[model samples]
Target chain A: MLKGKSILEPMDMTTAELEEIFDLADEIIANPPRFAHACDGKLLATLFYEPSTRTRFSFEAAMLRLGGQVIGFSEPNSSSVAKGESIADTIRTIACYADIAVMRHPKEGAPRVAANSTDMPVINAGDGGHQHPTQTLTDLLTIRRRKGGFENLTVGLCGDLKFGRTVHSLIKALSRYAGVKFVLISPEELRVPDYVRRGVLEANNIPFREVKKMQEVLPELDVLYMTRVQRERFFNEDDYIRLKDRYILDAEKMQLANENMMVLHPLPRVNEIAVEVDSDPRALYFEQAKNGMFVRMALIMKLLGIEVE
Target chain B: MIVNSIERGIVIDHITAGTGNRILDYLKIDTKKNTIAFIMNATSKKHGRKDLIKIENVTDVDLTVLGLLDPNATVNIIENGKIVKKINLELPKTVTNVIKCKNPRCVTSVERNAPHIFHLMDAQTREYRCEYCDEIVSMKNE
Candidate 1:
């Protein structure tokens, strides 16, 4: 049923559909070679209009692992986009060559435009801090794999919650599950947007509390998701410098956290998590990145309607 | 005062008395260039207080925003002193280049080159959303 569907936003996929993808990902993880030739003749077109080495490589690796070929540009300067081609024209032309497409553009709704232009499935890698549904999926899969299920878990989200697109997507996605509470850890200036708080959390009647310090809620969290507070997002450099050190998760802070609490980050991290924390068994960012490939592979296969033997 | 007859023009009727200026401000209508007549605080059977703007040389006006701002505004185009075309302005399907989206981070708010685009998602509710930021702008909020 997910075949020919476009994954543009986190809300685009229902709870049931997300569970199905998770199931597929679990199957793929348990038996990797089973889906090796599932997409043998298929081609995945990765149209990254922005510079994203991590996301582009993840999509390519997902396709290659599934026995599919990858083709497309990482930056718009190298493609016909430099020649003033519209997103519609580029997607339409690429659809002729590729069976599916994954795009990352600086413009919000660019992937939606691409999806509207072509019949092929268009996956939104990231759209100008608007939405990143796959990263949400990666987080969900990581949580499910680590914690066994999503129910009755206290998840703590820290760092730049205001401009963090992944944090927004994760909150929306996780709110659909049962008995999940949120501990929003961020500065007052970087609180989650009102629409998200109203539309997703409050509308769903999900319980959440906002706090500035992560250490206060550290021991209570089953999952701790951290994001980098970029210097660009802050208006004052001094404030960024002052607050940056407090938000960093060193081993001392990790000692105060729950023993079973899993630490996850949507990398490329910029010193938010200490290197010592990476050695902890609770640190799952590396595994989180690997899960991105498997989850995307499940998504690509399911969207393309390729039945695995 | 003096009643002026027009052979051909448009007559906007039933506008709330004090809102006539706001309607003009919204439309950016130039009274200096056009032969325009505005009667303020006029008595009406339906409305206790009303205003009317009659334009002698103009037949068509942009009714999209007018309807959004004031749905009760009625437009009557006259030809040879007889009403030829009558239209009751209604909310448009899509609105562009009008009220600014208040969200500072919205692309439409910061980008001068981009036209402010809004769509009337809930007509009965009278809710409009910025096409770029998806922020709902309500008449009550204005």
Candidate 2:
């Protein structure tokens, strides 16, 4: 039933279905060449309204590795969107040429609108401060492989909690699993939004605590998820500069964390994580990025109903 | 101490004082088509002061919206000048097309013809948030 399904939000698929994708991704991770042609002759349309070179490159790399062709624009100006075409019109038009479409737009719920207009499958890359289901998939896959499973883990989400789409999606996804404790770390001004706090955490009766500093809750977390303050989300540069460095994960702070804890980041980071910590075995953000492609491969094949050999 | 009874209509009682007119404005009770009588400053055993809205010869009301406006309101249906049924209103879990999301970044704001939907997250806290964006739609202002 996951085939031909539009992924507008993280809750689109059940946990068991997500695990199926992870199982296929794990198989691909073990031997990449075997499933190289699993999606032969297929086409993937990456319609990015806003330019995200890393996410665009990852989805493209995933489709290419599966022997599928990739098409679509990286920026709005390069496509018919610049001509004032609605998202509904553009996605419906693209469905004629492409088998599956992955879209990243600056407007929240743009993909959902497109999905309703197209018969072809639509995947949300990252909406404007909304759900990023694929990124949630990447985080889940990484956590499953690295930390064994989603249960009995104290996950600390740090920085820009108010506007981090990745954090919002991850919290919604992970809160569904058993024994997950949330330690929300951010300045008082930038705590997780009330909708997230009330919708996911309080509604589910999950235990969570709010704190100001990362170091105060370092040793307690099994996973330290770092996020950068997006420049576009801020109107004033001075506030961004003042608040950006407040949660920087330096080597000294990392030393206070548990030995088994894994550090993660949705990349293109701007000094949130120290360069020296990249050499540490606990740093999983790079591997997390690599795993993103594999998971995307699994997702594409699953949505296309392609039987991976 | 008696307001004339209607042949067939809806009588909204137990509304918090001064809110009956707001409901009339929201429901757009046209006085030309249907007769509306506002019973304001009525003394009640339970409420110190209460308001009532009596609409003559009207039925098939959208009870969902009335529940959101005031959870404590009561509606009585009259048929042939006799009370047929009484309805006690409770807050709906989700409301659609009622309140506009105030957030500029919200999809509901930009997308024309998009339905404005709000989900009641907390009943005790009276918290309702936009379905698309998570902006808390404060009930106090409206």
Candidate 3:
């Protein structure tokens, strides 16, 4: 049913549709070879308007692993977008060549514009301080694997909640599940946006508490979603420098977390998480990166309507 | 103060005082071509003070824009100086190009051709969210 649909945001897909993607991801993990040829004779166009390492790689790797060919530009300068081509025109041309396309743009809803321009399915890789539904998918799949389900879970989202599109998308996606409480740990400057606070969380009547410190909420959480205070998002270097290291999750802080609590981060992490914390059993971010590819594989197959028995 | 009523035109009444000019600007009605009466800070029985716009010989106005600009305002279509139809204004579910997405990062900001679309997020609060960036803008009359 998700065939030919663009995932511009997490909420665009219903809970049942999310479950379908997750189930397919689990099956792909169990036996990768079964879905290898799922996208054979297919092409995936990666249109990255901004600089990216993991998302672009994960998407290309996913397509390649699924026996599909990949074609795209890593940055806008390499493509006709450098000549000041509009997104609608670029996507219209891309649709002619690629069966499916994924775009990461500097402007929010650029993917939606592209999706509107073409019948070819488009996935939002990441938009500027907006929805990153794929990262939410990766986070959900990781949490599902570690915690079994989303119900009755205390999720701690720490650091840079304001500009973190992944946090907003994940919070909105998780709010649909019952008994999910949030401990929003961020500085006053980087608190969640008003729309996210009032529109998504409070609108759903979900229980949540805003805190300045992470220590108090660490033990209560089933999942700790850490984010970097991105330098790119800030116009002032002074403000970014002051808030970037506000909460560094070292081994000492990890001790306070529950034994079963999983730590997740949409990577390219700066100094927010210590290198020593990566070796901990709770750190699932690296595995989360791998899960990103699997989830995308399932996504590509679903959008392409390529089913495997 | 007495003002002549319009014939084959529209009358907008009960706009929150001090917002009459803004609503008029949104309507984009040409003052040179049409006979327009803009009354501001008029005493009202229900509201202490209100604004009204009575246009003569012009009935074509985007009710959605009017509704968003001033939801409490009432609209009456006049035919031969008699009221024909009255419209009770309500916030529309969706509006296109009425309210610009002020979010600097929104797609509409860059792409001039992109429609400035917003959807009613909370009707109780009279808040609309940008279709692209999800930035909230409340339509509460000041």
Candidate 4:
């Protein structure tokens, strides 16, 4: 049912649809060979208007693993975009050549413009601190696998809540589940925007509390989602420097967390999590990164309507 | 101040006192085509002071724009100097190209010929979020 659909935000897919993608991801994980040829004759075009390492690679790897051909520009300067091509024109041209397209742009809603411009399924990789639905998918998949289900779980999202698109998307996605509570840990300057707080959480009547310190809520959490305070998102370097190191998840902080609490981070993490924590069974960020590829594979298949036995 | 009522025209009443000119400019009602009486800061029992507009032989003003500009404003259809239809304005669900999103990081800010779009998020606060960037914009002075 997700066929030919563009994923612009986490809320675009219903819970049932999300489960469908996750279930497929689970199957692919259990037996990768089964879905290897799912996209045998298809092509995936990656349009990264901004610099990226993980998202681009994972998307490319996902397509390659699915027996699909990949074509795209890692840098916008190499493409027609450098010639001042609009997103609409670029996407419209891409639709003719590729079966599906994934876009990551510095401008918020750039992918949305692309999605609306073409019939080819568009995936928003990350759009200028806006919604990153793919990262949300990866996070949800990791949480589901680790915690069994989303209900009645206290999710502590620590650091840079304001510009962390992954945290915003995850919060919105998780708010749909029953009895889910949010412990938002961020400096007052980096608090989640009004739309996420008032429009998503408060409007949905989700239980949540905003705190300046992560340790205050660490023990009560079922999941701790860590984020880096992105320098690119800030207008002032002084503000970024002041807030960047506000919350770091070290070995000492890990001891205060619940034994079963899983630590997740959308990676390329800049020292927010200590290297020592990686050895802990609870640190699932690396595995979460791997799951990002698998989930994207499933998503590409679902969007392309490629059935796999 | 009593503005002459018009037959076969429209009457927009109870606009927040100071915003009448802005709303009039937004409506872009041609002054040469239709005779318009703009009454600003007029004394009123209901609003203490209000702005009212009467346009002769024009009744097709976009209510949505009017609603967004000033939701408290009332639109009255006049026929033969008698009120035929009165519209109570509500916040529009979506508006296109009415107000530009000020967020520099938004796609609409750079994209060529991108239509400025916003959707109502909080009607009580009159908050409209940009369709692209999700930046909240209040219609007051926009």
Candidate 5:
């Protein structure tokens, strides 16, 4: 059912659809070489208007592992975008050569624009901190793999909830699962947007509570998803300095967390997570990044309707 | 309440009580030189709660915006007070440069040169979505 579909938002896929992708991802992980040629003749076009080496490489590697061809530009400067071509024109041109396209743009609705322009399935890699559906898929796969299932879990989302698109996507994806509650940990200034709270959580009648300190809810969490709070998001240096240390995750803080609790970070961590906690067996961030490839591989295979060997 | 009725001007009616102030604020009606009358919190048989704004010396008002903000608003353009043009301010197919999309990551929010564009996905529901970010604007909140 995922065939010929474009994943522009996390909610685009239902809980059943997500489970199917996770099942395929598990197959890919279990017998990596068996499904290598799933997309032998298909091509993946990565049209990243913004610079995201991690995401770009993940898509290319996923395609390569699937025995598929990868083609496209890393930045807009090297593509027709530099010559004043709109995203619509760029997607149209890319769709001619690729079976599917993965796009990352600095504009919030850029991928949506591209999705409308091309016949090929358009996956939104990231769009100006708006929504990152692939990352959400990766997270869901990781959670399912690590925790056995997504239901009845208490997930704590900490740090810059306001601008963290991944957090928004994850929350939306998780809301579909049963008995899942959220402990939103962030400063008042960095709370999740009203629309997200109203549209996704409150509208769904999901149980959630907001708190300024992470320690208060650490022991109750089955998963701790942390994000960096950039200094740039704040207008004043004094406010940034005051709040910077409060959100940092250190070994001491992890002691207060549940012993079986897993910690996740969407990486490029800037002192938000201490190095000491990296050795913790529950630190699944690096593994989370690796899951990005497998999940994408499953996505490409399913979207292209390629049967696994 | 006797500003000469428009020969060809819009009369917005059945607006929710006290919302005329917001409509006035949104349109900046005072800045224009046209004759206008704003009737607030008036009783009506059609709409249990009603308000009216009558603008004279103008042919048309942006009914799309009015509908976006308040779908119940009915517009009647009078030519010699005979209701020459009557339109129940339906949601437009496309809206441009009216309200700001609150999503910070929206291209239209940050891009100074780009026009703020929105599409009316649900006409009766008064749902307007940013063309750039696909962020749905809730009129009740705005």
Candidate 6:
């Protein structure tokens, strides 16, 4: 039933649907080669309107590792988009050539528009500070694997809550589980947007607290999800500089955390997480990166309706 | 004080003072056929100061849309110069094509022909969010 299903946002799939994907992902994780040819004849088109080497490659790798082929542009300039071709026109063209499309656009809801225009399944890679459902899948998969379950965990989402699409998606996904307390650690200006507060947290009646410092809330979190404080997301240089160094996760800070508490970051991080912390046993970002590929593979199979052994 | 009354039309009353002209423009009132009277800064006991628009020979004004423009507004149906019916405005549930989605990432933003639909998230707060991207359509300044 998941065949030709487009994933524009995290909530595009129900909790049961998400659990189905996770279940398949667990099977794929246990034995990689058994599902290698699951999508043998399928083709994945990566229409990256923006340059994203990590996300594009992960998707391409996911498709390739599943014995499928990859095609499409890394940036808009190389494609007909540079010639002023509309998203509708571009995606309609891609649908004829590919079975599924993974699109990353600078504009929010670009993939949703593309999904509407095409019968081919469309997967949103990342839209402009919008939903990145695949990354949420990766985060969920990582959390499930490391922590054993989604319930009763204190998830600390630190830094750039205002602009980090990953944090927003993760918060939304985590809020769905029972007894998941959210510890929003960020600067005042970068606090979680009111829409998320109203729709996801308040609407769900999930208990959450906003804190300015990580130290005060570090020990309580079961999952400390760190995020880069990007300079581009800031309108003022002084505010960015002031808040950038405030949330750095170093060994000294990690020492304050519980030993069992796993640290996660939606990788390609800046100085928010120090290099020394990568060597720590609790840092799960690199492994989390690898998990992105596996989760994406499971997602592709699910969307294509390909049965895995 | 006898004001020009419509024989059969709509009397939009209790608009926040100084907003009569904007409502006229927003509603795209057809001035070619219907005779319209715009009363700005009119004294009202309920609202203290209000604006009113009385359109002659027009009775098909969209009440749901009028509610969005001015929630405190009341529409009085005039039949043979007597007020036949009165309506109190309430915020609409889903609004289409009135306001464009502000989020550049919103599907409606790029797909111009796409319906600019907004779901009323909090009716009490008059808050709406985009159906496509869930970006809260902040009412401030809009």
Q: Which candidate is the best by DockQ?
A: 4
Top candidate on lDDT is 3
lDDT of 1 by residue, B34-131 (tens): 88788889887899989888888787677778788778878888999999888878888788776677865554433335567788766776777766
TM for every model, in the order presented, reads 0.80, 0.90, 0.92, 0.94, 0.79, 0.87
Best-to-worst order by TM-score is 4, 3, 2, 6, 1, 5
Ranking by lDDT: 3, 4, 2, 6, 1, 5
- Candidate 4 wrongly placed segments (more than 4 Å): B1-5, B28-51, B140-142
What candidate 3 keeps of the native contacts, as a fraction, is 0.74
All models: lDDT? 0.84, 0.87, 0.92, 0.91, 0.83, 0.86
Can you write out model 4's per-residue Cα lDDT over A69-172, one digit (the tens) per residue? 99999988898888998999999998889999999999999999988888889999999988999999999999999878899998999899999999889999
Q: Give the runs in model 6 whose Cα sits over 4 Å from its true position.
A: A236-238, B1-11, B25-45, B48-61, B76-88, B100-116, B132-134, B137-142
> For model 3, how does the per-residue alpha-carbon lDDT over A52-133 read when each residue is reduced to its tens digit?
9999999999999999999999878878988888899999998989999999998988999888889999999999988899
Candidate 2 residues A1-309, lDDT tens each?
689999888899899999999999999999999988988899999998887977899999999999999999987897787787877778878999999999998877778778878889999999887778898899889999987789989999999998889999999999888999999999986788877898889989999999997888999999999998887777689988888788889888989999999899988798999999999999999999999999999999999999853
Q: Write the per-residue lDDT of candidate 3 for residues B1-142, one digit (tens) a residue.
A: 6798766899999999998999898788999888899999999999999999999988878777777787789999999889999998888899887887888888987776778888999888888999888889987853
Give residue A44's lDDT in candidate 1 (0 to 100).
Answer: 97
How high is the TM-score of chain A in each model? 0.95, 0.98, 0.99, 0.99, 0.96, 0.97
Q: Can you write out model 6's per-residue Cα lDDT over B17-122, one digit (the tens) per residue?
A: 9878778986777898779888889899998999988888888776676777777788999898899998877778888877678775466666656677788888
Q: Write the per-residue lDDT of candidate 5 for residues A1-309, one digit (tens) a residue.
A: 889989999888888888899999999999999988888888999988777866889999999999999999886788777777777777888888889999988878778777777779999998875688899988888888888999999999999887787888999899988999999999898898765786689979999999998888999999999997766556689977877776889999999988899999887688889999999998999999999999999988888888864
What are the chain B TM-scores of all models? Answer: 0.87, 0.82, 0.87, 0.89, 0.75, 0.86
- lDDT by residue for model 1 (A1-309), tens: 799999988888988889999999999999999999999999999998777877889899999999999999987899898987778788889999999999987665567767867899999898765678999999999998878889999999999887787888899888888999999999897888765786578878999999998888999999999998766556689988876755889999999997899999998888989999999999999999999999999999999998876
lDDT of 1: 0.84
Go through the candidates in order and give the C-alpha RMSD of each one to the true structure. Answer: 5.2, 2.8, 2.5, 2.1, 6.0, 3.1
Error of 2 at B68 (Å): 0.7
Number of the top TM-score candidate = 4
lDDT of 1 at A57: 90
Candidate 4 C-alpha error for residue B129, in Å = 1.3
TM-score of chain A of 3: 0.99
In candidate 3 chain B, what residue range of length 10 has the lowest lDDT sum?
B62-71
Q: How far is A229's C-alpha from truth in model 4 (Å)?
A: 1.6
